[model samples]
Target: MSIGVEEAYETAGMILFHNFDIRAVTLGVNLKDLIHPEAEKMCAAVEERLTRLGTRLVRQAQAVSGELGVPIINKRISITPAAWLIEPCPSPQAPLLLAQAINRAALAADVDFVGGFGALMHKASTQADRRLLESLPEALSRTQRLCAFANLASTSAGMNMDAVNQVARLLKEMAAASPDALACAKFVAFANAPEDNPFMAGAFHGPGEADACLNVGISGPGVVRAVVDKYPDCDLTMLSEIIRRTVFKITRAGEMVGRKLASLLGVSFGVVDISLAPTTAIGDSVGMILHGMGLERPGAPGTTAALALLIDAVKRGGAFASGNVGGLSGTFIPVSEDTAMIEAVECGALSLEKLEAMTAVCSVGLDMFAVPGDTPAHALAGIIADELAIGMVNNKTTGVRVIPAPGRQPGDCVDFGGLLGKAPVMRVSRFSGSNFVGRGGRMPAPIGALRN
Candidate 1:
């Protein structure tokens, strides 16, 4: 985490001119030790622990941000998946109760978000998981700060079509319960989900991690794009080298900030997630980076090739910069959060089909996009199944955060404001894959999974 003088100067320039910032400093806290047989007792224990730790995390993250002159956008907390803690409770309300407690603690502590209201159901689910899944509509629609995720597929365990089906049905219910379908924005479905992701709504303290750790998610799409803009006339290979170098510096700066914050909080420092997450600010966009790489816009022909090159260079640079790089450390194309992406959809340059093709090369899939409200539950299931299959077969982490904007039509828009940003409603195919995804069975692991 040592920052040389030269690197410091470069990072200062990045911060001052290019919107380089730490997107989130998420403190992952293991809650396995706090589980209790009674729902009230368990909820009480979680509330007490999270309130104290979350307060400290928010305070220290602010201090570190000011002390280093770097912006830390969101102070967040990730806990052990809530379903495991409620396994002993017989009450059907256990999940909702726990979610309320966590939400209260997050509000008390003044953190931006609290993630891990989720379960690992890549293959199958327990009774507790089923109970939690059923309560998602209530929990997500009711809580402002609590985020939820379900790992429905993985390379080794294959795809959990049953859980996928359940989540798709729950999503529609969640949309019905919340305005603008905002509840769906807080819930993501994943395949090969990362254990230590610092980004929501998919972050959780994996069962294998330490009791507490601090993970940092870095953002520098603007900085990288600025660098890419300078190499317009250069060939793709050289452009990649330059982008790689810029990300190397960005990752190093993020590691320095993360390690200092972790030390201040008296927790172990986890990985630096070098994902180029974008925002609505001008020039702060992964899609703009692609445009700078010579695409007319994202979703144009050759856009996938440009994205593939960009992400590969990003990974190589981050891996070179630090040994502790983890999470989904690649490019994020969340349509709502990136202005260029939103424009691409508005101009009809980006379609759902093209976005799907791009996801095969990017970090996550179908993030923060919107579709018409009348999209059938089975159609949503078909969409999730398609993305999850990409991750399952490719052995990469992919997720979906789609909003079925209730009563909205294609070409309409929904504004969630702040970092959730605005999204244009994209058209969904009228053709249904109901019979295909309705087959409730596991899609078997790939031949690559049999390597072990």
Candidate 2:
């Protein structure tokens, strides 16, 4: 990965002054080879492997961050899907024990989050997959650093309404077991989920991947917003060109850092996900980028078009930067994590329905938004089904990370603090989808999937 000298100097300025940083450097370690029939030994071996790899991951990430004078905000680890490892051991306690072991390993290594603690049931759930689903509420409620995901739908296999309904009830259970429904923040439901994504709550080492590798997620909504703000009167074509140029710089920086870190750790370099993920900080917002693009606020009349243009420009820039770009390489519009999005919801400029439409174009689906506590499980399933359908039909990766805040009503706010941030409870449709969701069968894949 090579960068021009002038481009490097400009990127360094963005890092030194602007709020540009590598969001995460995730080590994907395959646990398939370590599976054991003895539950006790399996758990111990998993813990030991994670602890050893995670510690080196953190140390090397920090060293790289210091060397480059750019901050790497998080060092994370993702393992093979827990259900695959737990299948060999039929013990009922296997899921919980494995989750506990993962939590311990994350803590021991001082890593922020450990992912891939769930299963893939895009078509159907096996006995072990069902067991893992049943244990999720307890496992997520008990563990702090462990994150989980379930890919209930995909373009090829269509939607698994049964697993979708199951995840809804499990999320409700997890919310009831935790204060402020924090556990729900750690879970994601996906359609067309990526195996090598380095982002949290959705990353996993796919069965087809190598033994171990390194992937990077780079974020710079602030940097892009700053550039867009500077060219206030630029035309739409010029605006896109500006965004593409800025994102190219961001992706190049990520490529450089990811390669250096992978070399130091003696692991193959995976991909750089140049997603413009936002935070609670004021300037760091994908919504603000849209605001700069001439939208008064997100979810306004032209919000979807703005987001589509932004995502397209970002992807083009990333492709220009590196051939290895993978993952959900576009703009992420998680409501709670972006101040502009939170304000949009508070002011009624954004609605759940509008967010569903936006998901058709954005990188991920209805992420980090909260709905009413009284929202029924089938209603949650309805929401998931709608979002997943978008991904399945469009052939893109989309996910839902919604929280049902306990005892909260529409307009009520739940403060999760830190990176999870605060979210205003958004209103859901009063009409129930129980009847539709109760029709528990696979929704067939779209015609698009038949291509090739």
Candidate 3:
């Protein structure tokens, strides 16, 4: 099916229209204020600040969107950790109470998702952190818009085998909670979590972040795929170079849009996350590009090699364009949101096993994917634990945001709606890991962790 010159030119035009992105710029805000003894006052303060902030986020995002033409996907807010907030409150019930407060404030702000609600126990989970972490089941189950994250490990601190053990158990409990526990999709366990990265559920307003700085998220998988499609016969080296040049240009556009948006919003400018994000739209897929690159299957054989090359090239290129290149800079392969990845599952080209394997070399782990509804909670915990282990050992940032669509069987199409997109229920192994995941203890930080 060789494309004629005219069709190639026309397709190129379409790709450029959608794919030429300086993706998105996001702002992370700290909300240590939300835990005051005067909960009412604290909540009111957050709501007011968020309202004022939303005006800036929306106005600036729209301005940037108008100028860039490539859609800035979301205008989100990430707050200072709920764990820290809960720690000072001195009550196990504090997390749930504060979560409700934050949830309301987020809604009032006209934002999409609000992040940072769990713990950071890379080595130790304080009594407060554990209480907050344990409360996630209730919080996510109770709130529709709040996103949660637990930083279980980091490159400098090594892995928190203990927290991993708890997270595994938490998933099992959450799954049993029925409809709400599935909200775990809003939760992520991160390794090497960055303070300024704008995406969620990992994005958190670190202590270093200003009260309200505007961070940016930039994605252009469609753009990169178009460039690759243009040179179908080119070798790996040539392909890499082309992608580098294109990403450099795209990131420059991102920096320009981000700075302008932040200035208009009257906030300090933050880092640009140069991740190869995707959408449900066709032609904006990393897996599809890999398929187009003659891989035959996206998660088989030379898949990791291709992914390693792709991620490295994207970083090398994006870093060149922006001195502020800082968010989740690696590529993402969240299943449902990525049309090509969903197709691969339908066609039997990608499996959960292979997807986790691919995560070993790339950014995040199995995300927004669907597995058999019959997938036991223990199995789900196992699923998340395994992926986090890869991040733990490899010393990278990896996470799992899997969806077990209630009662959906393998190959069944489940629509999560909105930005979550649709997913074909992927087959999960029938085996059990209950005994292993049930072992609740910490995985000590690896020995190589000297830098923080």
TM-score of each: 0.98, 0.98, 0.89
Tens-digit per-residue lDDT, 149-172, candidate 2: 999999999999999999999989
TM-score of 2: 0.98
Of 1 and 3, the candidate ranking higher by lDDT: 1
Rank all candidate structures by their lDDT, best first, as comma-separated numbers.
1, 2, 3
lDDT for model 1 comes to 0.93
In angstroms, give how far residue 179 of model 1 lies from its true place.
0.3
Clashing pairs in 2: none
Which stretches of model 3 miss by more than 4 angstroms? Answer: 1-16, 67-70, 90-93, 172-182
Q: What is residue 251's positional error in candidate 1, in angstroms? A: 0.5
Error of 2 at 311 (Å): 0.7
Query: Model 2 — which ten-residue stretch has the worst lDDT?
Result: 9-18
lDDT top scorer: 1
Q: Which stretches of candidate 2 lie over 4 Å from their true place?
A: 1-9
